[model samples]
Target chain A: MDRVGTVGIVGVGLIGATIGLALRQRAVAGQVVGVDIDAQAIAAAREIGALDAGGSDLDALRPADLVVVAVPPDDVVSTAVQAAAVMKRGSILTDVASTKAEIVRALDERLAGRVRYIGGHPMAGSEGRGARMADPALLSGRPFLLTPTDRTDPAAVSMMTEVAERLGMLPVLLSPDDHDDLVAQVSHLPYLMAVAVVGAATDRAIGIGGPAFAGLGRIARGPVELWVQICRSNRAAIRRSLGQFRRELDRLERALEGEEPLEILLQRSRRRAPVDGVPLDKPPR
Target chain B: MDRVGTVGIVGVGLIGATIGLALRQRAVAGQVVGVDIDAQAIAAAREIGALDAGGSDLDALRPADLVVVAVPPDDVVSTAVQAAAVMKRGSILTDVASTKAEIVRALDERLAGRVRYIGGHPMAGSEGRGARMADPALLSGRPFLLTPTDRTDPAAVSMMTEVAERLGMLPVLLSPDDHDDLVAQVSHLPYLMAVAVVGAATDRAIGIGGPAFAGLGRIARGPVELWVQICRSNRAAIRRSLGQFRRELDRLERALEGEEPLEILLQRSRRRAPVDGVPLDKPPR
Candidate 1:
């Protein structure tokens, strides 16, 4: 694969730092420059060799072949718009945000043809966040979903695909709406359910204990402010997903209240099993 | 700790095999006799060194100094009753069941003073079940809740505590009802919620294109039969927990339905942070 030229990364947090580490390990021929509003984060990125040079100044990204916007979901649009203003003409741009449709729409409406922008979300993370916790192997063996709008340049998409390949990620292409809905069902909904359960049990009447609590409360540990932004930004899709979840809860309630045979409950629950997977245990004789 | 003599394991299955292994590894000076109705399981126990002698005969437990009943909730009563009939005059009996109230009630009514039965639940397990998955270190550093009825013998409780200490666990004393409620809130209800969400997603559409799908689908990989049994046995408590969970869901729904500020939703979710004993990160500066 051809080496990438100077690459600029905005928001040197967990995702940005990880991308920088991945770039270095993969030896992508690029002078990776990181830019973060937080001076401490910028300093940390430099200390960890995650950036050749980075600062709050937009001029730091002026000479890059590609620019990656790795801010929170709420900041994706404003950051992308600002970065686009200072970007070299025809420079390709991409973002690692959870929601896609909104960013795609924002870029399409506000920065048409000034620079190519493609939306991408890597389905990976740890409970911990920030550059300090960044791992080079975080994206390895994970799926990276790319949502390229009709107006997106093919070469831009191709370039980002090369970067994803260099990071050892399997890139899958989907539309913006499709990506949003998929994440709502799989990621956003589960997170909401986890938060709700943990909230309900926070009272003194219940004591939290065991691996089950940790497993169920795993996503509840996510940054509340970030989640609020995510929930707000993706409200429509999240509400739709929550509606589906509510219906399922009602079904379970009915089954329990009606004293439906155990077999019926088992059948309904068994549908949750992966279609192609065997039971967690080997078959009992 | 003094070496246990003639250990009796009732309803020999996964937990029984694991206890046997732990005892053997510690070189407890005793013969491990396993009792189970399933002849195949008894054979497997002997083959795996989980038992020195095995049979369907409850009478075989007569000489045991310590009797551990590892059985399903529904079978706990009948098995305890049968084992109590032939238990050694001064032996200590303990049961490792998920719910404690029902078993404690059963033992109180049936055993009387024939033998001492203390209810114990080790908060440890993998997604798998059966003797094949048994591990000696399963209880290491795990909390073992012991729920002893008022009528329970002090000597018996002491013996069970010693057993837990020997196995390297922290024994926590709680009332049977409290134990039931704790597990219902943390373990049983969460499993049900996970299964419900997984089922709901699978019913609608399967977008299994990322690690998020696999992460959310993990609990769904658990055995349906085992979960069905657990849900049915702990129906009353789980129902109450689910009701509380539903109210939280309703609150979230109301928040979403209203034009209320996003801060309300975020506040409710943030309340769960302190209960988890971790300081939540502040929203991005």
Candidate 2:
């Protein structure tokens, strides 16, 4: 693949640095430029060979064909808008945030006609934060969700998809609302459940917990502040998902009084089918 | 380790076969014999080199120094009693059941004054069932819970501990009630939570689930029939655990209205400690 012109990445944190490293290593970008408020992050990214050029200014993105806002979920919209203001006209702009609906809506409204803004969320991360922990292979084979509105440019979507593939990611398209709701159920809700499992564990229970118990509590070990932001950002969908979860828990609790009911509930729970009506027996990808 | 003479396994299923294989492969046993009502299972165990000798009769345990009832939870009690009756006096009898209170209580009463009954639960398993999937290394470094009542012989516990070590297990001693309660919170509750997660997931939610969601749902993919038996066998403890989990969920839901409360709850949830007052940062052992 011919090197795409300069790629500007905002934040220069884990995701941004990883994108830089992957793009540079794979020769997908002619120059991988990074900008961050934290000068230390920029230095770290440069030291790790994740950046060809780096700075703390938006002007650094002016010559880039693609600009990626890789900030936290709460900062993605503002950062994308600021980067878009400096990006050359017709150049594509995208983001790597977990939640999408609010960020995409904000960016589409604020950066309209300035740059082609498309929402991208690489479904990958590590427990450790910052550029030091960024790995080029982190996003490989993981789902790269692109939340594109009908108003989004087809050219922009195609560009982002190519970049995602170059980074060894599997690009999947969804609406911003769909993306938020899907993650609320799968990602956000499961994180909360893990937190609940850990919070509710009795001292006695902790004493004798084997691998299964430990496994359930594993996902809860992520940073609390980040998860708190995620939960707050996608509250409605998470609440709805939480309600659905409560219903299932209630069903199991009610069925506990009788052997047959419990057995039937478990049997029903075992049936798993994909959205395309495919029976799925394999572990989740 | 001196070779343990004539280790007899009552059920040549996954756990039983794994035990047989590990014992024989490590030369921990002088001879490994297996008995299964299912002739096919017996053949499979023999074919896998899991047993030196095999049969469909309890009399196969007549010369055994130790008999492990490696049957399903529902059948553990009856199988243990039967095996005890067939074995000569002073031979140790143990079981490999997920839930222990009921099985241990039944065997302690029935096999008293005959064979020394020590309840053993090796906390290792695979989603795959039967002798064909038996793996000797499956139990390596996994917890081996020993639930011994006052009536249980010290010698029997020591012998089971020695055997568990030979199988590469870390033996943990807990009372029968404690064992049931601990698993109810950890194993059984987590399994139920995984089921609830699967049951509650919308089609669209599943479509976009990343690794976190997949990891949470992985534990639920085990055989439903087996889990039903486990849930039924430890109903009271499981119900209590479910209540604790529900209370935590309720707290989270109620706190959802305010950021500070939710943040506080998550912060508290992040604190993990072992029973010995150790700040545990490690995954469950």
Candidate 3:
């Protein structure tokens, strides 16, 4: 909770680099250190000034008041555990992985009381991956969710919230299970939908696609390795969302095949309409 | 063939009024005429200067050198037939309906060489509908598809192409069936996907949706009556695309559940990379 003296960032990927840039702009820390197992990535982080110093050593994070694990979803658990083991006692530790329930469960099972660990997931991400696409502006005005259970340190959560605010993100609190279910319905489901649409298409179909088609399938091009882990880790919730979507799609298909009442089918959208109490059936005059 | 002595637009809804505005800007016609079954729609179109003259009768389009029908899918065939009966022979006629084959068949069966009729579809529409949302710039820089079979008039196709270009649109040639199949995969299927996703979602889930969720579900808000008609008219093609998508989703789901090699699944995206063929595994250095 002390205005963090030093911030150590492990895995200088897009989220990591963007976070590093934000920390630097706010001068919230006396020094920033970036660590990566990929030696060349450490060099890239240093060249871009995403760190005051960079190296392939975990020991460098020992002095940092806050350590952020921004590694891939597959590596998040082990890397977060490693950061906890090396960093100073009472120093806050957090991660920016998308899927939360399992990671928070894994961390809570391993690192609680040893190191202050609060899980975070930022909602902003670009279609383009890696540090080259990272920007300080990327995190601007975005939402970040913090999953803290009864076991989490209260002061660590407050410090993490302050850091998220300085990065220009609004912080919301949720339980890890709730976070996964909510994101599965919104974020994870959309990516799977895009992948399904694009995978079923041919080049001829893509050639004719404009803004609507492109926007709808944009995230299907995300790195396969990353998405595989994300989808697998959160399989149950994703499957539930997909099951609901299939039933909804069947309803629409049946309606297309028969003289179904469209007004009844569109009843939900009407309730969410931004318009005044005007009936959609009555076109503007 | 002719420089459109008088351009007539039927329907006076969003597409119809937008066409009137474009024709007026180019001065391609001696005068632009607007006609609609709804009397108030004509008043709205004229009030916006989208029409030089407007009326509620089909006969008001009698003096036109060309007529553009932009009504709903259910009304397109009958409206085109009515316009053909009233407008003079050799006066080119086209309908801007999303689905083409049925309407083109309806025109060929009824008006063959009696009046030149071509099918056109502009790849531009807003979530907002009607004359109040109409803009002269709406059709600018959009793609317009002209679907023609062997029986279609060459001069009518040329005139429609010229009109599309004047409105700053690119005109592409497509067979009616080909157009339907392509749009089914890229456009119609995406819309249905959005509807299914949004329709199945709870308000809590939508509250946390980011860009991917919002953009993917954006078009689900299109008017219910129009979308119901669109889905029904093109049911066969849409069903085919949806079937393909479901199969594709099953494959990805199995991959997430099993120890499948993600690289093989992601091969197409790597080939289509905007990056320098750097393996996504190798984080940027």
Candidate 4:
């Protein structure tokens, strides 16, 4: 896919700006052009040297060899469909949205013949949002999961893998359904658990809190508008993961309440330790 | 209380080394001597200038106007009892153990009139431990909770506050029981939740794991032996907080499974926002 020349980046938000920065850092030969509904965001991308040029016009992106939709989750499908309608034939398109299954289905239904569309989710971000917090190094050493459907062309998948490798990310390939289930367990479920724990701490009867509470609760402060769309779109998987977490929580509660020996609780927690892969180390400063 | 000069610190581990460093920075009109069970730790503290003098002997702590016990949680009370027996009659004593009620109770029951013991828990630490990581700035702007029982000398509490203020930590007065409950909600409960989340993720059926899982799981990686002691000693409060968390998890489970709208989940999580306080913009790099 060396013929993949120009790269069109839709939405100059954190993810878009970061991808642009990463491309520039690696000196990827393709011309990186940005498209954003926000004129100010386009300007900010230019100021950060993340784009050769960017504007509010979608037509400016039509000639690109590769198109990346980095809009919010709710906008991913619609944006891809709109961009697909105007794209040059054989040009590939992909998204960096959190959830994949729905977006993959939407792209399949709307943009099947217009361009090869792949779903991508980079498991990296700062608590802060927008262009200011965008770092080229943000995706370094992070997993960049790609969900390619049966309809996706093999060359398109390889082309996206090339970009992910250029960004210093480890690319993992999976089917759309597999990707959704995996993230439901890792990303989405943990977020819900964080929200629940935060809710419990804020209960009036408890009046319980400390720095640790704050640290654990910090995950709940994400933009609600964005998360709402994600949860609604991936309801089935999210619900399943939530059920799994609840069962574990119940097990812990029963252990705490029962006069079970402390060794049992310790053993239970220890047995579950291998899930994290790496040895539990102190939180990074 | 100006007469309370020359503070001696025993067990120059993370807490002890940090206290010595903070005292040195504040120049609190007192000499700071450090003692540790590990000769290497004592030598390390001396090399870093975290102590005016260092040795492995408890006798080296005898000349101090006040003594600070900063050992692991398990050794807190035993060390305090020993310090009380050896420290001069008018000398004050304090500790930086996470759990306050137990240590305060131990001091009250074991060393009633021998020394003025006030318990303090500074809510600050880096993942880095020992003298090499010691920084006077560690406690700045962090909360330093003081749990002084009625039997403890008011003068000792004031002295502890003076030190906290000098180090730039906000001195918060709390009853031992209240402090324990607060920390359980804040610290212990979060640690337990992290462990549980990590454990749940480890289940073989799910097979989904990555750095995000590892990042969230890092809280469980703290010295397990330390946590074992902490969980065992603070069992009552930790168990209660965990129960409260479990109830919230049950509610979330029901909501996710039942016909609750997506907005309801968002609203529930938003209401719990205060549990996190202000977002930690970014940790110190």
The C-alpha stretches of model 1 lying farther than 4 A from their native spots are A202-208, A258-285, B27-29, B37-56, B202-213, B257-285
- Give the alpha-carbon lDDT of every model: 0.76, 0.83, 0.79, 0.76
Q: RMSD, model 1, all Cα superposed?
A: 4.2
TM-score of 1: 0.89
Model 2 lDDT per residue over B1-285, tens place: 477899999999899999999999999999999999999999999999999999899999999999989988998887888888889898999998999998888888999999999999998886679999999777887779999999999999999888888789889899999999888887888888878887888766675667666666567667877888998899999988888998889889888767347888886656662322232654334
Best by DockQ: 2
Kindly report which residue stretches of model 2 are placed more than 4 angstroms away from their true locations once superposed: A1-3, A132-137, A273-285, B273-279, B282-285
Question: Of the pair 2 and 3, which is ahead by TM-score?
Answer: 2
Local accuracy of candidate 1 as per-residue lDDT tens digits, A64-83: 88899999988989998899
Compose the digit string of candidate 3's lDDT tens values, residues B146-255.
99788888988889899888888889899998888888887888877877777777666666667677675556666777877777788889888888988877877776
> What tens-digit string does per-residue lDDT give for candidate 2 at A1-285?
366899999988888899999999999999999999999999999999999999999999999999888888888877787787778998999998889898888888888889998999998887668999999777877789999998899988989888889889889999999898888877888788877887788765665656556665567766777777788888888898998999888888888877248877776656562322232654234
Instruction: Report the number of the highest-lDDT candidate.
Output: 2
Scored against the true structure, residue A115 in model 1 reaches a CA lDDT of 86
Each candidate's B-chain TM-score, in sequence, is 0.86, 0.92, 0.90, 0.90
* A163: Cα error in model 3, Å: 3.0
Candidate 3 residue A149 C-alpha distance from true site, Å: 2.7
TM-score of chain A of each: 0.90, 0.91, 0.90, 0.90
Q: How high is the DockQ of candidate 2?
A: 0.45
What is the lDDT ranking, best to worst? 2, 3, 1, 4
Stretches of candidate 3 above 4 Å error? A26-31, A37-53, A259-263, A267-285, B24-30, B37-50, B55-57, B135-141, B259-263, B266-285
Candidate 4 local lDDT, A11-92, one digit each (tens) = 9898899998888768874688999999889888889888988998889887788899999999988898888878898789
